[model samples]
Target: MNKPDVSYSIFQDWRANRGNIKAQFILSLFRLATWVRSNKILIILFIWYLPFYRFFVEWVMGIELPWSLKAGRGLKLQHGQALVVHGQTIIGSNCGLKHSTTIGIRMNPDGSVGRAPIIGNNVDIGAHVCIIGAIEIGDNVAIGAGSIVVKSIPPNCVVVGNPARVVKVNEPVTSSYS
Candidate 1:
């Protein structure tokens, strides 16, 4: 797998969540919180500020995106409510997430915690979607709403329904997002 970009610019991500006040506020707050955690001197300040951050991001915004999450650039969160992404999940660049989506891990039968999904670039996921387990979502994929994705998906496909069977494959990649 290719290495993820180490450089993180809040402005670039802000541009993606632009025109949406909720998305802008939530993402900016997350970025700032992460930045503070990354700095040794600022971590001291974060110790006192962590509670407020959790309250606002979890209770107010209704988003459970951890500051430690490795999300890529241009992550557009549409109707950013009830969205929960696991900290271990790696989301690629130019991905769109709608409301009521859960991208997390599935528990093992032995009652152990499992790994989260690694989503690829330019993937658009709709509302009421649950993408669970240690699956890999390929780039340029579009997932319909109310879908439950468990298995790994290939690149450039359109998947939907309860089990998320691939309905279309090798679809053309779109450049712009609305």
Candidate 2:
């Protein structure tokens, strides 16, 4: 038997590693919405998700991710509920977000609305983590449960606690998840 191509194998691996079932469903809907919004031909089909968007956002998945939010490939939602991400926020590939995690905006000192957080690749965000403001979370970083992050985090660090302090640095990214 002939072996599969490298690109096909990589795609299969990505599909296999797409977190839980809930995450897969929500991500599918998000991708559909994004595609519908982008293609002028599918503009008429947007009505399917328009009326039910609030219901899906508030009740079903508890996620408020809009089509404008730029989420990269291999995004994982641990619990896939009560997770709020700002429309302007940018998330990198293979990032895992747990329940009740909010990545939103904050008010600046000049009374202006600040930008949302930019999450890096392979970052694991624990449950109830609130990453606010215009901070940039670096790659291969892990934010512990219930962390209130307001500042930019460097790469390969583990941050925890409220107002999030870096507890560990130069840590390796582990692929195992329970």
Candidate 3:
């Protein structure tokens, strides 16, 4: 199934944190715009989402997304469509959530639900990554394309493949950084 688009509170949460730099926010906004512009197909689908995102929040889901959702300074969503963020998910600053990423919890044995994910800052989640359960992803971790992340990942690691093995380390993105 396609991931749903992000709602207005995503940006609102980022903006509310005054400690987050303005330059980083501008850069993130720029990144989002440029990435969407380059991908016309994604833009078309997301265009429709903007209205719903701007108009509806209460009528959509029951979970109340806490302020910031633990999302830090610069949150960049590249073609984020059909993405589901459960209330338990905790993200960090300068994170990248690509298209179709679902950040939620797993089903219990009795068909209830487990704990939410605790993601660190400066992380990059690739498209179609399903991160479930009570995993604590470290800072600057990059989840690879089409990965299913169930376990906790250490900081600065690049995770890939089914169940996602650490393929590389996240060397800080120094250049062109705000």
Best by lDDT: 1
Candidate 2 clashing pairs, residues 3+ apart or interchain: none
User: lDDT of candidate 1?
Assistant: 0.87
- Candidate 1: Cα lDDT at 70: 83
lDDT of 1 by residue, 137-173 (tens): 9999999999999999999999999999999997565
Instruction: Supply candidate 1's per-residue lDDT for 136.
Output: 99
What is the Cα-based TM-score of model 3? 0.60
- TM-score preference between candidates 1 and 2, better one: 1
Name model 1 segments beyond 4 Å from true.
1-8, 171-178
Lowest lDDT block of 10, candidate 2: 1-10
If the candidates were sorted by their lDDT against the true structure, best first, what order would they fall in? 1, 2, 3
Whichever of 1 and 3 has more lDDT, that candidate is 1
- The root-mean-square deviation over C-alpha atoms between each candidate and the true structure, in angstroms, is 4.4, 6.2, 12.2
Candidate 3, 68-151: lDDT as tens digits: 244444566565445667755777766777767788888989998898999888788999888989889998888988999999
The positional error of residue 103 in candidate 3, measured at the CA in angstroms, is: 0.6
- In order, the Cα lDDT scores of the candidates are 0.87, 0.78, 0.64
User: What lDDT does candidate 3 reach at residue 146?
Assistant: 94
TM-score of each: 0.89, 0.82, 0.60
